[model samples]
Target: MEILGDRKFVEVPGTATHELPPLLVRMSPRVRSLERVLGMANDLIEQEDMIPLPAMPVEHDSERRRMDLAVNLVDQYLAFVQHWQWGHSILEWIRQCETTFDTRLELRNLLRADLWPHAGRSSFVVLLEDKLIPTAGVEIEKAVGMRLTFRQPPPLKCFSDQFLFYLNSSVAHTAYQTWAHMIPSPVSSLPPERFQFQVVNMSLD
Candidate 1:
């Protein structure tokens, strides 16, 4: 204090002290601006009936809702794939029956067509060709629910390769033998009891 006894300090004439916001609060406007732009874009996109995505306040409920939506979509796709595989399987079973019984048959003509997936227009001649069979790896994976998880492998091996094994197994063969005689002559509709596939479900690990 003794060294600069005459020195004096003064504030600038027009300067005034003001408190600035914290770092996060100061940056929020920019972030929120970007968010507004993104939200508008997503809203416009969703006008075409796209699924709504969860955003903001990341928490368990939002996360679970997102997961449920995803799972529902997966279930729907699986159902479609299963129907395809089943139709192919039924066509295959019919061919085997034709070979085993040494006779031709047709589906019963009903007033209203069934909604079940069918192989090739529900006609006798169209199903004879093996072109509609599920042979690709993707088809098999979808049908048998194959995955890279640590879960136990499905009972059957490659479904396409081992189709005959399951189709002619004791359970399936007995089911067929029991119901074959009940089908109407020339035209018949095989019910699920007569023929159906066992769908393998894959649970989340």
Candidate 2:
């Protein structure tokens, strides 16, 4: 029998340590121990200047599995820290891996939402001369809110998803029909013209 903090634990004969780890003695004490170790580790890591590199979005499932493996490895290290309380290497490595997952998630979300559109890259605005005339001969409204010139950044709205879709869809129906016929027909009773043109009509719509 041994006492850890205020509680007493009975050690079983011939029982492997893995069967009932020391941290499992009490649920509440185990959680508090982990939190305390994490707090101290944070302070030490910051003081030692051992912060991990900024995490990037994972490009493949394999990368994701590697990241998860790092997390499980960190959890194993925490058992070391819970007892020794002086495993700086253990704590630092754990903090680095765990922090990357959080940071990468936030960065990925920001890239998907705020940075998704080309026009959202910057907030800067430019104005044209009040007397400027458009070469396209379109009538300009006298309203103050009307923007009569291109003032946005390089990519502009032309690079946006909607604009790209519009540009691709601008081809004439006759051109699409001709292009579709150039391909060999499948083994079906439908005429070659109907088989391909139907696909073209659906795509245009």
Candidate 3:
């Protein structure tokens, strides 16, 4: 057992380590550990500056495993940061990734609600104009003020599940319709007399 800012923990090698993301630490009771572990965690973060991407040579199986562990640890850490803190210090990390080809960005489960995910990619506002369109908030009561409740959820992958996706689909359809109307209609091959110039009446059978 060890003391970490008043709490004690069992120093098991693999157990407490796997859940940790190398980039950002998770804020929870699980983070209990000795001062040394915390120092090592801080060192892991500091080491990123000096060490390059693909941190070690991966010629042998052992070396490859080491490289994989390093990369995966950083990847897991970045994901944890995004999940826990949306408007986090993700911009600095993104810029670093863009600086080199070896650095890769693997992000999943992106949402429109978050304030500008690509803010890191381009520092200028011109490139970010696309995401400027505001979306309607699904608020139950505006009079009482905004409050998010997550106790009950709707059906999985249902039509109502992705409200923003449906909104984008609608916008796409409208744009397609507008473009379609702009195109000229095709001319008939046969003579004008062969086809009736007037509209024909048809049965609803």
The global C-alpha lDDT for each of the candidates, from Candidate 1 onward, is 0.30, 0.26, 0.26
Which pairs clash (backbone N, Cα, C closer than 3 Å) in model 3? none
Predicted structure with the largest lDDT when compared to the true one: 1
Alpha carbon lDDT of residue 4, candidate 3? 42
Segments of candidate 2 deviating more than 4 angstroms: 1-31, 52-74, 81-205
Cα lDDT tens digits, model 3, 1-205, are: 2344632222222222111111221222122233433344344534543234466655676545545544544333323222222112222233333343123222221111132221222221111122231212211111011101111221111212123223423433453344323423221111111112111112122
Off by over 4 Å in 3: 1-59, 87-205
- Order candidates by lDDT, high to low: 1, 3, 2
Candidate 2 per-residue lDDT, tens place, 1-205, comes to: 3444643222222332211011111111123344444444444444444334347754575445544543433343333222222112122322333343236432222212222221100100101112232212211121111111112111211232222224322322333344333433311111111111000111111
TM-scores for candidates 1 onward, in order: 0.27, 0.16, 0.17
Clash count (model 1, backbone only): 0
Better model by TM-score: candidate 1 vs candidate 2: 1
The candidate 3 region of ten consecutive residues with least summed lDDT is 139-148
lDDT of 2 at 51: 35
Output the TM-score of candidate 1.
0.27
Candidate 3 shows a clash count of 0
Candidate 2: residue pairs that collide = none
- Alpha-carbon RMSD of each model: 36.6, 35.1, 30.8
